[model samples]
Target: MQVRLEQVTKTFAGSKNTQATAVKELDVTIASGKLVGLLGPSGCGKSTTLFMIAGIHDVSEGHIYFGDHDVTALPSDKRGVGIVFQNYALYPHLTVWDNIAFPLLNAKEMKKRLKQRFAELSPPMANFKAYIQRLVEEAAKLVELTAYLDRKPAELSGGQQQRVAIARAIVKNPSILLLDEPLSNLDARLRVQTRDEIKRIQKQTGITTVFVTHDQDEALSICDEVIILKDGVLQQQGPPQEVYDHPANQFVAEFLGSPQINLVGGSIKANKLYLGNEEWFALPESLSDQPVNIGVRYENIRPDRENRKQAFEATVTSIARTGGTSTVQVRLADGQPMRLHRDSDDVLQEGDRVRLYARPRTVYIFNAEGEKILQC
Candidate 1:
């Protein structure tokens, strides 16, 4: 289902006689049958938006729509939405079969209401029963849980239990599926395994899914589109790669990367870009003489041994080797820190003075207010 949040807002009455806004005039759209991510820091309203869409929390203002249906006023049971919680929310006493069948039984009342809504166009009850059974079987197979049908959630591993929960949610064939940090409880290896499993299931089932996560890697890896929020306000929304490559603002640039983008003090003077006391490159004609911040990704900055042009002379402050790559932290002449990603074999000793050059195209320019001024 195509899900849209139109100017939605939510607030909580604080104990100090003030209102705290959980979501601030947020607007987003998820295309039908696609996985979209709501990514942000803790207390940034990502979960609140998901809750609102799932009908678990009422919107303080504005509306929500699933396709053409105005579901803003609907109750959780009436919304035809399925949700997977961080803890999985499965019953320990119930077997996997009962858990997966729970939604189907609960959906009977919903089906009655839906029948009332579309009595003239609705299919017969016999067909609906067959349809629900097929959906349950298909959902269980999608998550590879058919073999564990008789096992209780307590008897399953964390990953298997999670798959059972996913199967339960999907068995109802909800128009929109809301997942709130579903992978947070799994081990590192299982998290990776389940992440791919969720993506594969979404693709094959063509179910519209809204994933809420604070992990940037999780959002970037599995989502087709991403909506970023900060301080309860919408910051940016677009395709995952587009948002990462061309962050709308500095917050996004800093939040979306692993090693984080390096922000160095720079200036545009007489149509030239200067870092510290040396001129790095000639500035574009549109960029006048002004103070600016130069943003460069870790991988884009390379340690140069020969060339000095477009380079920063810095002392290596620290080195972190993580099996596949090493991150070298460098302190510039002005005391600003920057990082470079290199192979594990390409090691550098601390206190060694090195020259680093950043790819021109990978560099970003931000104004005083931290909004991106130049994407390239």
Candidate 2:
């Protein structure tokens, strides 16, 4: 289903008679049958947004819609949204078939009794049995749990149990599926395996899904679009590659990268950029001669052995080799530390002075207030 949120906000009473806003005026639209990720650090309100969308938490202000239906005031069970949590929430004593059939049974039983009470309805009770059986079988096959139909939750591995939880949710055939850090409990290898499986299943089922996670790599790898939050506010939202390539602000630029982007303090005098008491590069005419932070990726920097331009002389303080590539920690002339990646055959020893040059286009300039300033 296509989900829409209009100025949604949630607040909770905090200690010392203050109020904490969990989600602040968030407005977003999730297209039908797409996997969208809510990514941010802990306490950034990703979980709160997911809960609001699932109708588990009430919105303090604004509205939510599923297609043309306004479901902002609907209760959790009435919203037709399925949620799978990190804990899986599987019953250890119940077999896979029972677990998957539980929701269908409850829904059918409720509908059956309601139909029985209506005097105008003379339909036979036998008609519902076939429908329920077909739904259960389809759900089991969707999650690939048909072979383990009779197995209990305890008899299955972590990944298998998670699939059971998914099957249970899918049996209801919810219009939207909410996943809250579902892969956090799995091991490294299992996490990767399950992540790929989730992508495959999502494609096959074509259900609109909202996945919440604090792991940037996980979100970037699987999600078609990503919404980043900071301090309960929407910081950035865009395609994964677009956001990674052009961050809206410093927080976003710093949060999305693996090794973290490097920031060096520098001043713009006249038209020249100065760093470490040395003139580096010429700034664009629109920069207006102000102090700025230069952001550069580790891989964009190259260590020079000769004929370096605007090089900051540094000594190798430490080296870390991780198979194919190595990270070299260098101490600048100003005593600041910076990390650079190298794949050169000639390795530099500790305490060896070397010159480093950064590519011009790879440099990102941020003003004093931490907002990115793009060079035209």
Best by TM-score: 1
> What is candidate 1's lDDT per residue for 1-376, written digit by digit as tens?
9998899999999987999999999888889998999999999999999999998899999999999898999999878888999999998898888888777667677666534544453454555566556666787888998888888998899999999989888877688889999999999899899999999988988999999999999999999999999988999999999999989988899899988888888887887777877788875556767788888899888887569677778899998878867889989888888999875556589999988887677888877678766545
- Where model 2 places Cα greater than 4 Å from the true spot, the runs are 108-127, 305-311, 344-346, 374-376
Instruction: Give each model's whole-structure lDDT.
Output: 0.86, 0.84
Candidate 2 to truth, TM: 0.90
Off by over 4 Å in 1: 111-135, 305-308, 344-347
Estimate the TM-score for candidate 1: 0.92
Superposed by TM-score, candidate 1 places the C-alpha of residue 43 at a distance from the truth, in angstroms, of 0.4
Compute the lDDT for candidate 1: 0.86
lDDT of 2 at 319: 89
Error of 1 at 38 (Å): 0.1
RMSD of 1: 2.8
